[model samples]
Target: MLHYFFKIYLKLTGWKATGPVPKDLKKFIMVVGPHTSSSDVFMGFAFRSVLKLKHIKFIAKQELFKPPFGFLFRQAGGVPVDRFNKNNFVDQVAEMFIQNESFAIALSPEGTRKKVDRLRTGFYHIAKKANVPIVMLAFDFEHKEFRFAPLFFTTDDEAADYNKILTFFTSVKGKNPELGLEHLLN
Candidate 1:
């Protein structure tokens, strides 16, 4: 099906996924880091296809669900969320995990492709609130590889956990290294 197509696409694009696949986990929050390019979405789709993890969904702004590219996003397991709303997104996304028998979502910790002072904590809070583990996914453009870390269960100590997460992703080089999280290591 589309999975095979995406797999072929990855090969054609000179990209490959390399890491341990978490096939046993029924639900978890996957944090993809160094999201320095819009092309990450297409690579993510190919990565998901290569890993055979089509069930892992992702959230985007409501506008991306509109015409033109909307259909493609929906087909790629995208769930639109209202970014302007006052509603608590963490709670809303946590509820999604509670309601589903098996649900996994991918989020970008950097939140934007631009350099940032620090990573967002929404993924951590959602994983903690939903009682699910957080998995780290790395986009290493230097190696042309999509890497995955094992299930990382959030602990009570937020700072320590963030340190560990940050350490894991700091070595990864993104499509746009200048805009990636490597600077946060300082």
Candidate 2:
């Protein structure tokens, strides 16, 4: 399977995965951070595959569904969405969780590879609204490792939860270090 192959690839490349494997991660939001390069896609895929996560999905733009890699993307659980249209993307994704027996959506808080003043809070809102936990995944290029924080579920105070999430990312290093979190809350 692709999962085994990716695991081998990660091992050969000197990258190791470390985190707690939840018994039931079925319906949760995976907030992947420091998405600074196209390489993040491959790395993320390998990471998920190596972890053998089930029903892990990413809500990507519909445009990415075109061309030669479309099949591959779908195979990787890429859910295509019309990003340009003014639709309720969060609700749409939340519905996926409701419809599926098990679903996990991996999304970037930064939204794009370019530098940003702060991360978008959609990931947190999605998890909160959907009544699911947020799994914080970090690509620490400095340490040459992939790290996952303990499962996070938001409480009544969003600020407290956000601060806790930020603390976990403090030591994370992205492929493009310069572009990663110069001001994560600006």
Candidate 3:
């Protein structure tokens, strides 16, 4: 019922989804991109509903799970992560993935809605350590579409891998003007 509602909401809002739906869903890291607004979460939720993804989870700050919002986060398939604990979060998530073969975690490489120069590398490390593909999903408000790109295989050359990611984002239109990567090309 909730999923159907979200689907309807997405359609009403003129959001179209593109690309092939993932078939080999053993385990993966769903990397959402160009996250510049809270609306991105709504779009992602709608995509998850329309995709009918199962056993998928996303990371959130531990504080969101501390009080009145904890239940809401859990209900939304959020995994509370303590970023300040100094523990190796990527390794911890990788271990979790190894332990649960069906886990599919979503991560926003931007790490925030504000503009950032570089993406966080935690997703890459986690995907590499877990030996799972990184599924790239982008929300392009200008195109009014949600595009899913091919799964990324993490290689030893982190910079090269990031360049591929940047290229993918470059192909996506409607990126928030403030979050634009014009500086990356210079």
Candidate 4:
């Protein structure tokens, strides 16, 4: 019911997903990039629904789990995580992949809505630690499309891997173009 509703909603809004869908994989990290606006949450939900990926989950800063919008985030499959604290986040999340037969978490590589000098490394580390593939999901607001790059397993070379990730997202335009990840391309 909700899936069909969102499917129609996306179609009506002229938003569609491009590239391949990971239907076979049971566990992996879905990296959604150029998260320049909060509206990306709704689009993320719409894409999750339209893709029929029920296991897709997200993590937000613990602050967002507070009053008012907190309940909404929780209802949207959000798990509040402490961003400031190291707290062995990578190991903890990696353990989750080990325990669950099927788990997929979508994370914003930018780590914040505002523009940054470089992309965060947590998502890559999580994928490496969990021994799962990384799938790129770009919110290309310029083209009004959600783009997916083919899933790829992480290698021992971190810098080279990040280069690949940046290459895939360089052309994507976020809702707030100025706040997007284009700067990282330099």
Candidate 5:
């Protein structure tokens, strides 16, 4: 219903979705990266709609679940997470995945629109513990295209995996100049 409408809207607009459909229906994690602006939300929403992906969920800050907007967030498959908590969010998410068996949780490794010293490693940890592959989603505003890279398997070498993930974002062009890697990672 609403998802179908959004998919049509995105097609009418300039946004394009390119990616591989999931082969396995089991649990998995999606890593959306180089998040640089509010537009990332719109783009991600549009992509999700286009894919017609049921059971897809994203983790958002708890504050975004306030009244009026809370319903909308839930409607769009958002799960509220308290970012300030010292608890093991990764393990918690992994447990959820294991319990659900069909869960596909989405996260922005960048953690915020602003630049950061390094990408948060929670996505990797969750995927590894859950024994699920990662689906890499990226937005190239300059090209007016959104790409879905092949599912990535977490390796023993975390740094190597991180570098591989970073390589995909290297060619993506964003409207904001500050979205470059300098501000993205330490």
Candidate 6:
């Protein structure tokens, strides 16, 4: 019931996923870029429903797991993080993948809903450590579409790998396009 409701909601809002989200790969990190608004989460939920994806998990602040809405978020595969205790966060996330038979996490490379020149690189490191490919998704507000790019596999040359993945986001416009990295978009 909820799946169809959310799928219908996405269509009502004129939002549709561009292509089939990769499903053959069971465990990987999904990178959604230019997260400039809180609505991104809702959009992602709708997108997931539209795409019929149920196993992808998301990381959120520990505080959000406190009360009424916490259960809802958790049911949707929300993992809580204690930002104050930043020790081995990447390891913890990687551990989630390691422990699970199949898991996929979605997070913004920018790390915040604000302007950023360079990506946080944490996602990259997590993928490398977990031995999984990074699935890139773009919230192209300019085109009013969500676009999925090719999966990125890290090579020994980190710089070259990062450069190649970063190029895929050059033309993508986020909710706040002005806040995007000029150098990156250029």
Q: Is candidate 1 or candidate 5 better by TM-score?
A: 1
Residues 124-160 of candidate 3 have per-residue lDDT tens digits of 9999988999888878888888888888789989888
Per-model TM-score versus the true fold = 0.89, 0.88, 0.90, 0.88, 0.85, 0.88
- Model 1 stretches astray by more than 4 angstroms: 63-72, 84-86
Tens digit of lDDT per residue, candidate 1, span 97-142?
9999999999999898888999998999999999999989898999
Q: List the candidate 6 regions with Cα displacement exceeding 4 Å.
A: 84-87
Number of the top-ranking candidate, with TM-score as the measure:
3
The lDDT of model 4 is 0.87
Candidate 3: C-alpha RMSD after superposition: 1.9
Query: What is residue 163's positional error in candidate 6, in angstroms?
Result: 1.4
Worst 10 residues of 6 by lDDT: 177-186
- Give lDDT tens digits, candidate 5, residues 1-186: 767787778778777767786646567788876688888887777677777665779887788999977988887798887767776788678778888847898788878887767888999999998888998877777777778898878999988898888887766865574764544332
Q: Please write out the lDDT profile of model 4 over residues 1-186, one tens digit for every residue.
A: 878889888888899889998877899999998898999988898888888886788877789999988998888888777767766778778878899999899999988899898898888989988899999999999899899999999998888899899999888988988997667765
Q: Please list the residue runs of candidate 4 whose C-alpha ends up more than 4 Å from where it truly belongs after superposition.
A: 61-74, 80-87
What TM-score quantifies how close candidate 5 is to the native fold? 0.85
Worst 10 residues of 5 by lDDT: 177-186
lDDT, residue 103, model 4: 87
Query: Model 6, range 1-186, lDDT digits (tens) per residue?
Result: 878898777677777667547777799999887687878888888777778677788998889998878897799889997777756778888888899989998988888887776889889889999899888888887877888877767889988887776787666877777776546733
Better of 1 and 2 by TM-score: 1
